[model samples]
Target: MTVRFELYSTWGCHLCEQAEQMLQQAGLSGQYQVLDIVDHAHLFEQYRVLIPVLACRHTKATLGWPFDQAQLTAWLQLQLQED
Candidate 1:
């Protein structure tokens, strides 16, 4: 099963940058789509305070900022199970 992730974030956000680096370190960089909330009105509103969110498109699961490698891995596992 191929897992796809959507990273909701905006430019110049430190947390967003960290989240992206975590994804890269996890070897998930290619499987994710970076969606800049600033490009979409609804997305910006929905995730204004929740930037740096990692979302599973198939399961509709979301992980907010301040996550580490362990949390990201667990979140992915949970989302996979839900799918």
Candidate 2:
């Protein structure tokens, strides 16, 4: 089964942009969706200070920002195993 991911982010956030670029660089450009926190009140409240978070749609597992490609790969692997 294919596991999809959500990238929680907001516009004009440099770090968020970096996270997106990292995903693209990691060859995951088509594997995840970008969700703007500003459009969802609950998400906005929960991730207001945690934009750039990557979440597994199936497991609800999350990885916060400041993560590199290696960390992202490992996280995805772990999530796959859990699910």
Candidate 3:
């Protein structure tokens, strides 16, 4: 099965948009899901400062903000190679 990666984000967040665009430009569209925190008060509250966070759905491994292409790719590769 393909691993599903998720990005925690919100509206009016420039960084969130940047992250989304980075993912897309990195050719990650349709491979991962983006969850807008604005619609979920609880999640938004928990991850407001940590917007643009990435998470592995199955393992729940979270990667906080300020990640780059290499970091994102390496993280996903590590997860995918795990048994």
Clash statistics: count for each candidate:
0, 0, 0
Better of 2 and 3 by TM-score: 2
Lowest lDDT sum, 10 consecutive residues, model 1, at: 1-10
Supply the global lDDT for candidate 3.
Answer: 0.79
Clashing pairs in 1: none
lDDT of each: 0.88, 0.88, 0.79
Best candidate according to TM-score? 1
What is candidate 3's lDDT per residue for 5-75, written digit by digit as tens? 88898778888888888778767777778889888898788898888898877777888889887887788
Question: How many angstroms is residue 31 displaced in model 2 relative to the true structure, after the best TM-score fit?
Answer: 1.4
Candidate 2, position 43, lDDT: 95
Clashes of 2: 0
Q: What value does the lDDT take at residue 81 in candidate 1?
A: 86
- TM, every model: 0.89, 0.88, 0.81
* Deviation (Å) of 5 in candidate 3: 1.4
What is the Cα-based TM-score of model 3?
A: 0.81
lDDT of 2: 0.88
Better of 1 and 3 by TM-score: 1
